[model samples]
Target: MLLPLPAQAAALDGSQLSLLWGVPFAGILLSIAIWPLIAPMVWHHHFGKIAAAWALAFVLPFTVVYGLSATAHGLVHALVAEYIPFILLLTALFTVSGGIYIRGNLHGSPLLNTGILAAGAMLASFMGTTGASMLLIRPLIRANDNRKHNVHVIVFFIFIVSNIGGSLTPLGDPPLFLGFLKGVTFFWTAGHIIWDTLFLVGTLLVIFYLLDRFLYAKEGVQRQDDPTPDTVKFGFNGGRNFVLLAAIIALVLMSGLWRSGISFDIYGTELTLQALVRDIGLIAVIIASLVITPYSVHEDNQFGWEPMKEVAKLFAGIFLTIIPVIAMLQAGTNGPFGAVVRAVTNADGSPNPAMYFWATGLLSSFLDNAPTYLVFFNTAGGDAVHLMGPMASTLAAISAGAVFMGANTYIGNAPNLMVKAIAEDRGVKMPSFFGYMAWSAGILLPLFVVVTLLFFR
Candidate 1:
């Protein structure tokens, strides 16, 4: 077992940190947004290095100013408390889901495509956004490979399956899971936000169906030669991985529900026994997937580690660079982002649900939504009981914002980027980082406004 650091070596005080400390985080985001568009080859080859450079840019300067011990503590806390668990769960999901290959192709009629999206939306809550996206994206792409105008299909898939669909259950998204770990009841989100989810999902589905119908009509009956003809009967391969997927879900649920009251302190970070068991269990699941999955399944699915690698490397830097940014936000009114914290409150000091919705959402668009949800959850007084009771609307707003608006940008959620990477790898010609934002701004922003008026207000 690891020994704890002295109590004096606690986390960095965001109240004392200057705004300049956020430069590296902004730099990384800009690099992600611009570099790929301007210089695709360089960005692809050296993106990890670029991410690492930005991370070092923050760490090196921070170490000099705050002393090595403080910087070390911060880094340890960020990794031990946040990043490692995050990547492990993602890895397990990616491996297990990637192993399951849906054989044969179904033509992507507008109605059929809409039905698949609807099914994926339902699956996302149970299997996780990452798992559901990986499981369904390949089949969706295969189904639509012949379509002339299919980009909208993929974009809407990201919006519906990978983000908004995950809103109803903690098992669906990271932010909600974090909320669960913080003592929110298991079904609280479903009970509170079911209507909001139904409205957004139902509306998006109708819009997708209509748009796809229009595009399908414009492209004529046969848009392009079907790259994947429906020659074989439709079926699933790697069926055992489904069992592993269930095990993954069980591990996650067990971690949240089982209280061992045992933990270790690595530097200043607390590592709980249930979390340790969950991580170890996930590792076992990943190994089991790779070992038991048939080689033919992997081949037919065209499954590769590149998408997972891209997500892991990029997020390593994001989680690292975001350290001081989270701290500053956590500092509340005293921090540089005091305006953001203040926007969620009224003059009489009651939480403003609409402002909470927008504030949590806009920031979650660029920043990591999980921690952003935590910041706002605490900002609304951190008592889950009170938030779930008198402040139920506020909690609901924060939850909805973090989970739903994650589709606004590619990097807003881990699965979004992974889906983009996989789609592009399969020759989908997906939109660029900013290009995706244009789609979201046009479609989702208007819907979000309606959501704010109808629900948050």
Candidate 2:
């Protein structure tokens, strides 16, 4: 039996809320960005608690001011409607990908590294970014273990495989999946942003090739003692997980395609039949991955729950704290974020494609891109048909920006940090938060400008 909500429950009005309500959101993001750099041990041990405290910082005061009913409604909506499904899909992908171990290593020549990156880019659009990253990152690291200048390789991996490579389809990234759920056709992104994706990814690949070649030669003919010696043969362990990965793709597609007019309302959040089935199926996939995969494969992969646990904890806080921030964005021209709305609109009141690209991309760099996509999407009138047709350029700009520029920061996408953590765990010294930005700012930002000019303009 379904339980009842409070009699006076209703949605929070963004127009009525002030910008002070956004503090916890900003605080948590800053903490994620800064805390680790300033105090690594404390942040590492207590990051989850820090995230929860920020979540409560918003919830407690909001409940006091708005009443318990409204607070409960907001929490339910964020958790049930958004966070649960988001994390479940990520978990399934992480688990299945973690199960499969690439058994042999290759020499990390610039050409071979580039080839692996290109292959990962193609696989990303099919398997999801997290899946592709988890499956390929270790092998790439193992291949490059003997090189003196290998940090660039991992950074480029995050750029190509973790972020930009995911631009081709909804399965590639969370923001795109959210677009698919919002009535976008299955192939809409592939059709709309194919050329744009090709330009950005191709250019980055060329740049990576040249830079890697330079560094490879600079390190001289002699190499360090190879930590992970290359095997004569290359193959995969836990091959069954590949089928589970395919099942995950099928389940995501089915949820988008199937229409059952059946849904249940729980605490003002609508729970649809297809969505429930998809989430349940994902749970099964996770269990099956853990059960069917051999322990040796996981041992070889060094697969553990730390990365997944970290993502889950950090994002739980992100989703909860972002409630009011998203509410304000939803309020549009009348809310605290009114200036953001006006920036993306032309003087003639038509949507400006370039502004949509930058606005969505910039905000997405700081905020979670999924909800950022939704915000700009609604600001563009929330008509899927219209956006897909007459305002196709506008939609393309938003889609490309959200998917591509997530490389701007580690927190821009979930997999960015996961890949970083994995790299660090493998003893690859990653750049600091701002240090990483120096890399993105120098490399990615210039390319984004070119993208803006070539495609967005």
Candidate 3:
């Protein structure tokens, strides 16, 4: 069930791509990492233009070398094959989840926060990292808003809800979704990484529980002005969007299960019928949720399009600029990045599942994990059948690495940044870029090492 490569008239030679082609991608990454700290006003106001500049930096040179037609094919390939579907799915999840507000005035406690985190982790594999994050983050934040020392709640929220929770299914993480589209079965990830996921989630929950308990003890009592009533009764508003959420899930599943062999040739890229249906259906769901759901629901959720816009603009630059980098990795020993390829392989030429895990995870911690996953997947021989057969462990390693280590940094996945921005806007003073990394370095890295030894070994 491997999708056919686009029949491009003039395929760019990855071997011919110089390492300098990576500069634009690096530029965007640095901008994302550094600009927000050094010049917050400039980044907030002009980040889109900056992202577009980096994209054009890559696209312009590519057009000059590859001709307008081939350049059109590449753009079309990135959009049709990757970006459009990606943003649409995100939009659907963001919109649908935004409409359904968890209306309550409940105070957050160690037990309650951990319980909420555990529930969100379960919902992630089914609703998506983005969907589940959007649905739960505000509630979690609101629950702990009155607490004096509540930053760690948001941090662990990112750790579990935004990253590790999504390891179980394609719906959970973008990388897994890319794998599914590239012909990995839907349940393939759940089957391969079930134990690893459970172990990591269990251990993290235990650690989070201890940390929250210690912090809870320091807060002498709830603030005098805390609005959360002692006997608050919880209810869900915008219940209509729940059906729409189910529709989104159903459409995604349909795209995978019901391949009618129908497809369209869009500038040499083949867009299958089911894929088209899925995207169109998702778009419809987004529109319906926006139109049907009352504006009050969004207001209650404090929903704004700024975070979504940031993600879309930034990722547009990322998907476009990453072309050369992915091409180089796929080129293996024949390309400028041959050392990267060699490092992930055994001397016998067999795949090293452990190296694949760490290499993919570390890079994914910085790069967009979807394309990062694609690079290593192609490196491990892009045949889905073989990858699921003899190379199951390697695929599992890649899957686990890409999804889990996304918590290692803010931009590792889109939701991490979104959750941070949302939290900060709600008055949580989030850590600076390197400061956040300091948190992950001490917390997640050791846990990941243990996960590596226990499962990847």
Candidate 4:
């Protein structure tokens, strides 16, 4: 049961429950524990049957811990506290291990692949970063079809599909939803449209130039004796799933109409109209997609379930290992500043949303973006003066910054790792955990620096 904030805080302070931090930290340690078992397999792309293995390694732990926490008396507070972070983690896992194609196809030119890739990246923000990444990864690998250095292609895809692509609207990313929840005008986030579009175009063009150069370098290695692989065509396979994908989008939009908030009905019954609407809507979309997509999958000779299996495997690990960590962080938060060491306000009494953005976003990348957004949002709201427009806009920017930038690392955004897993399945080599960060530090960090100037300054 979801307890209100005041009730939650009262429960925590009243119960002498200071050890709650252990739960989330334990979850992190657990993730590290299984890295050896799963990381090697993913690196070599031995993903033929990784789903079952991942289930045992990751999901089992998450389930047991979550269940234990759910019933352990005071533990309920920690579990509910970490709910948003849990969802973000799940979303990242699903996105990274997307259910779409992952193995390279027999045919498609590099230029053609890049074009398809760009379109897919743009589409990812809408279908969710995971959905788009899963659908396109296999085709992307096939399009690059024969490039020896396919890792570069997959890395750029992470930058576009997993990160920058989700900046368009609230539907594009969860951080944007944080803004929406705070009474941010939906159209207000559209103000980011121009900057978001520019970044997307720039990122794609940069990828194209780099990919073309890499592909060109391999021209000399071709031999006439080498057999040409069979070519694959776009919109030729699983094209019908696109319609189901649209249905999912519709369901998500409808969920917005019914949000859970503090309200009561007649007879003092707690009527959670919003929660019911969203929960049911999400269930409908997932069910419809699963049912509808299989019908056309075999007609295109694309019925192997590698991508979906990979998602199940990797996410199971993520879900378990991070639960304790999210729980602890939830307990650690005391208020606006809470236990976080950061500036919360300026000399003139304005909420320091920029600092909140950076601090929250950096932690969100490593920890959990959803709660990280909330922690900072809560802190910003602590200032009595921040209840209005400019302050609200600042809070929105901070929320957006945290959610959007969380995609900067593989583990940052919910969909990132899913994209990586899908890319690996398709025979594209994604970077190691830390190796990917180097790219983000170089490219994404610079972009955020510009954002700091353009938006916050």
Candidate 5:
């Protein structure tokens, strides 16, 4: 059910601006009216601050560029809804995976901990970065619970498990799936696997080596007596929720399969199966995930709906307040932005993949990565160039950038907020909004610069 990047190739033709602005705005208004019921969750300390910051980030720029740009309203909604189920699956994965149950000794040799980290990274590639992160984060915290200098461990977890490890497959991340739908062969993405995996493994080996060297020296300074022998059993008080998560993923796959068929003829050009999937899958997944997952999951595990409610409050504020501004940009702002994109042509007047990679990635860090990826993909139609190899390669790089670097911040990807919420649910105090950026700016930005120099460049 993965969508192709080329399937998203539609120009920024403005229509339905009123409805685009209105729906998200109304969703926001309704959310606020329900705030009293959502108070306990939305008002939590961690999310409350994040909600405020998210509001400011979306609002300030929206106000400044309200009438100066234009966008494709349908594209934005299509992109948003397309990945909503994936987001819920990630949320469900973290919520049920014993959220943060960890058992182990921090006194283990540095070599042993590194081994465990590598295992976590491998799991990330299969189950997804967010799922791996959520499942392992609590255990990582618990492993280092007895130690004071554990921040480095957490940082490296984000680096490998959350970002780098998922470079090989569509199941690993949404952006890679974009490439899959775009006619790139299923295993084509695995071409980058060697470099990406090496980079992650090498980086973690070095970082964790240095960290353990320092932290080990400090061990004696605050050492405590070892606990009683044979007491390492860990328990999940909320272990029965795996069924809920399974149901969510099943529904997501079902919706994806179902929507892959809904299509129509347009101007004598029949829509491809890929296009049909992207367009219809979005609506199908959103409706199904929202209505079905919540009800089914609620039956068994009745956690105070705190996490989802918090996300709803913040995202509602974001979608509502920025609609008019986004609508205006979509209506008439194509010349400057589109010119930059449209002007960079191949020797034969085709699109430039490197430019697409950088542009989509840079904006994706701020705007929704999904739409940003679609905008660039649609603009660079296959007909723009008759040659196949270069075009496909270019699209691959763009897809990687959008999906991989999106882990750089709490808001860069939808799963990011979900990870943070689940982390908090396990009692791990994740960084503040800007504090998270500080983490990304240090680790992920450097990694991205390396990727730019090595691959995208």
Candidate 6:
């Protein structure tokens, strides 16, 4: 559910919004970043409360300052409109994909892991990052469970499948889908960003293979306590779920294509008929997947709702606290964040596409990429025709930046964290937030620098 801003209401006047309004948003993000490292036990226990406190820190004072109606408008807009739709979509994907158990006793050799990652990267463009990651991660994890040095495989999986792999189409990732809704053609992203995707994704895959080959040699082959050691035949356990995955894709596509114009007004938020239909369809998909999937399939997959629950709780607060920050960004040059806008622009006022790439990427690395892309998209004049025409480079930069750089951190995109949580739950000791950043800084940043020169420049 997206809150439709009336033509009259440009959301909030950026000039009137102060830097003060943005502190809680910063607080929540910082807590998400630093707290998990210094206080893992407390963070795991009371993260939801931390998220809620930050949300209330903004909402309570905002109500006092702007009046109850304005506060209600803001909260309802973030909660009922954006957050619910986000969580439900993730839940539906996680639930359905978890039922799909890719059963096989394939060795977790360098070649096998690379092949699985490559397959997942291709599947991501059709089934979405969340769907593709969930479907393949379990098998990948199981394959590597017997190995000593396997965390690198998960890291590269995040780099490729969870992030870069989703660049080809709107269904692959949220930022691209937001662009689609803003009137960019369905194939526009793939047409413009395919080269970037190919280069970055291909480079990452090659790097992973060489690195894994080195690590495999260093660790040596040890099958002493092998879980599924013998080379059993490969087969999928829940084939029917493929149909459900296709239906999810079709339903998402329908939401974008259908334009009935019917809408409901909740507080100040407006929910469109198509969006309402999409959410309802997603709920139906979740229910159907649960009912149709056998209990054993889930048990074998080791499926649980903890990952989904964590994402929902954390992002619920993130969406709310982000409201003011986005509003401030919308304020542009007159607002507190004016310098950021200035940095991305030339002295003559045309957008620097390269700067747009880094700026969008950096923000998307921490903040939600979908909204970050929307902000920069609108900032670059918000006209699909112009963007696809003379401003084509600008739009492409924003699009690529949002999608590609999300792999920079676990919290960068929704599915990145989901993959991390799921991997940790399955007993893989994933890196801490900063530790993960070390991996990206070493492996991904150098690749991005090359990308900046080849594409954005």
- Candidate 6 C-alpha error for residue 396, in Å: 2.5
* C-alpha lDDT (0 to 100) for residue 60 of candidate 3: 97
In the range 246-333, model 6's lDDT, one tens digit per residue, is 8888777787678887887776677789878988998999999999999988998778887777778877787787777777776677
Give the runs in model 4 whose Cα sits over 4 Å from its true position. 1-114, 177-188, 192-197, 200-204, 207-211, 214-228, 231-233, 257-271, 295-341, 382-388
Residue pairs of candidate 3 with colliding backbone atoms = none
Q: Rank the candidates by TM-score, best first.
A: 3, 2, 1, 6, 4, 5
**Candidate 2 vs 5: which has more TM-score:** 2
Question: lDDT per prediction?
Answer: 0.86, 0.86, 0.86, 0.52, 0.53, 0.83
lDDT of 5 by residue, 322-396 (tens): 444333433422422335445444656666666766676776675556545555555554221321355665666
Please provide, for model 4 over 286-332, each residue's C-alpha lDDT reduced to its tens digit, 9 standing for 90 to 100: 45545554443543334444545544444344433333333333333
Which of the numbered candidates is closest to the native, going by highest TM-score?
Answer: 3
* Predicted candidate 1 versus true structure: per-residue lDDT over 154-190, tens digit per residue: 9999999999998887778989877876678778999
- Runs with alpha carbons beyond 4 Å of true place in candidate 5: 1-109, 178-186, 192-194, 221-230, 234-336, 340-353, 382-389, 414-439
Model 3 residue runs over 4 Å out of place are 1-8, 218-225, 230-232
Instruction: Kindly give the number of clashing pairs for every candidate.
Output: 0, 0, 0, 29, 10, 0
TM, every model: 0.89, 0.91, 0.92, 0.68, 0.61, 0.88
Worst ten in a row by lDDT for model 4? 6-15
lDDT of 3 by residue, 338-444 (tens): 88878988998788888999999998898768767887887886788899999999999999999999889998888988899889998999998788899999999
Error of 4 at 82 (Å): 9.1
Residue pairs whose backbone atoms clash in candidate 5: 4-181, 4-182, 9-378, 10-378, 69-329, 69-333, 70-329, 70-330, 70-333, 71-330
